[model samples]
Target: MLGARGGWQALRGCASLPRAQPAVRLRVREALGAREPAGEVKVQGWVRSVRSQKEVLFLHINDGSSLENLQVVADPSLENRDLTFGSAVEVQGKLVKSPHKMQNMELKAETIRVVGPCDTWSFPLKMKERHPLEYVRQFPHLRCRNNMLGSLLRIRSEATAAIHSFFQDNGYVHIHTPIITSNDCEGAGELFQIEVSWVEKLPETHFFNVPAFLTVSGQLHLEVMAGAFTHVFTFGPTFRAENSQSRRHLAEFYMVEAELSFTESLQDVMQVMEDLFKTATNTVLSKCPRDVELFHKYIAPAQKDRLEQVLKNKFVTISYNEAVEILKQASQTFTFKPEWGCDLQTEHEKYLVKHCGEVPVFVINYPYDLKPFYMRDNEDGPQHTVAAVDLLVPGIGELCGGSLREERLPFLKSRLQRLGLADAYEWYLDLRKFGSVPHGGFGMGFERYLQYILGVDNIKDVIPFPRFPHSCIL
Candidate 1:
């Protein structure tokens, strides 16, 4: 936002107006909500559009407070080169009832001052031009001025607040997990190891005295906290060095993770995931109706009805065997064939969601070997599986993944020993030594969740600064 004027420039615009009622400074959103007719007032915002007529000049200005712009009707004499689109300006005027049906109030400008001037010829965005997401994405520094991104960020903020409220209201203690850690929660080996600028390798001489890397998930640390606090949650940035540029993959992203102690069933974890999604979605819709409507109206036309169905109905659940069977019988051929032990591919996940009426589907009881060592073993038979679950939504395939953690000492010890991680995770083994309880947790990709709800095809657009393969734009 443009800074306020100092000394004399502060009172210049409003002071020039014939003072009957004292001028009140109101934001664009506040001015737009006038009932009858407010007296002298002042508003400041960036110029969105300027329409000059023979009698009057119509200017639409916005201050990023809302999606809608406040209409400012000024005399044609007030129009100048500096009042072009994308420039910052302040207007002193009388806020009166608008005769136009589109809005409730309009500003009858007494004076207009251009606070900050913009070079219109060099501006990436143009007046009355609805730039596509891909095009606007190129200008990362200035793309927020675009309507699509502005609406997305607003909705993202609301959803973030709603998530925090959901956990806090449900008796969960929030935790700040570490950004750099020695433990890999998922055991995927995809990590961004930290390094000093000039040093090559620092083992004993290292700052931390051991290898450290950016976190892949906060689940492990949350589990440590859950031992003390029955319920705990973490909402923060997590990183992975994945080299893919798929719409669903990002090198840097956020995860919403929660852990619950004294809960043995995957059903408990699944219930939390479903509840969190529905609660956050409802809040985002209520708080940012028009912003959400922008994506539904223009980006994805069918999303409105699709979202309603998801919110109103209960999520469907199927065992991993059942999911594999459904996929095997499907008439559609997949790039990766659906097998019992193989992890579900994005293609397979999309088909499963569509097969289940486009609602979120929870696939539980995956093969024991397919999941990480932390997941509790199902302890059944030749075709063995574990108590692991993944939530699949409509467009994006897997929105969340969770499992009931291995609580028994012998079971977890054996699993870690087989994977050669027993020595590395001695501290984790100590957690079981100190009276462990049956517990489970799940992690949902925050950006993926936003992508799912907003109908945004590209994951890059939902985040402010996307870090991906060979590209980290400011």
Candidate 2:
């Protein structure tokens, strides 16, 4: 250890040294957006294609920043055998106007260096061949190299940013909810329990003294925060062990949940949900026009007009009873016919959307027995109902679900007791005892939302790595 004087001198010596600066680099999107040619610029990316001629070698390089690849023109002498499709390389070149009509600029390479060599025979992706989405799903580890999936990822990133901005601008406090908890928000009895192995005899007590599981939703935690903050939101991963193999179900996915305090009725919650959907969609459409167009042109051509209609039309609202009545009168036959007390199936939801002129529609006032214990009782005389709502869109059935929470302590305790869950939710009951205001919230499945927006039929394609029943590929 150094003395005081020695330490001070050492500190002064350290402070006199120059700090290191990060190396300057430009993304492909940024480079392409330049107004004038850049001199002596350096670019590094994976080669998408390479063509060799007697005089010159042309390479198409992509950095996953945009759908379009950077055109690189190199002298034949600088070409190496490793500079093939999917090989990572760095080039020192000058940017110049391209003679080709496809792109505006090209890189005139002075020197080329191979950073990493990819085996063309083993690579799943091929040059100049369009691979179907299902075909690319087999290679989750390398699917981001494809132009379509890469564009989807970029759009997803932009949408996430837009959501955060929307919440922050609207005075909502962002909260991080716990990933492990003892209580299930949905009470669906489909939780993934956490278990730990023991070296010796099995321990009598669990890790948390009680059972724990991956959270199904962040609504309860957001509600806790809402008790303090007027408006709170959480965006994170949520898990469900439904063992569903449908196109819209996932074992693990992302959810965006928001809780609003001092809400008077269910309409307030519905309005916020509608606003969030529109705002985020508009932001994505404006910021990622090319990527959105790519999906529309190739994947789902019919979705473009539907999306425009969704943005333009006011979402239709109807009571659950009205929806059931309409379904009952429809000429279409159903496997599970629409009933008054049963939960709405995907077929019923799709029919409702189509009936509403192919626009988003909100069905409210669901039967009390159909919803969870936390929903507020509407007390509508003979047939009881809950102040709950579900937002249904054209392609996807139910996009969002929310309700006004039960603020009455006695009613909440009674409902919990009836469900045989009062002991597990003592703390939740205490929230009402201390001080509870009229509050409501909704949860939107991020993957499903992306699926509806991009018009991707399979939920697996929207997520980077999909987790489902009997499938958990990289």
At residue 469, give the lDDT of candidate 2. Answer: 88
TM-score of each: 0.93, 0.94
Worst 10 residues of 2 by lDDT: 19-28
Counted clashes in each candidate structure = 0, 0
lDDT of 1 by residue, 373-413 (tens): 99999999998899999999999999999999999989999
Error of 2 at 338 (Å): 1.2
| Candidate 1 off by > 4 Å | 1-22, 199-204
For this target, which candidate reaches the highest lDDT against the unseen true structure?
A: 1
Q: For model 2, how big is the CA root-mean-square deviation?
A: 5.1
CA lDDT, candidate 1, residue 166: 99
Model 1 lDDT, residue 61, Cα? 97
Q: Among all windows of ten consecutive residues in candidate 1, which has the lowest summed lDDT?
A: 1-10
lDDT to native, each model: 0.93, 0.91
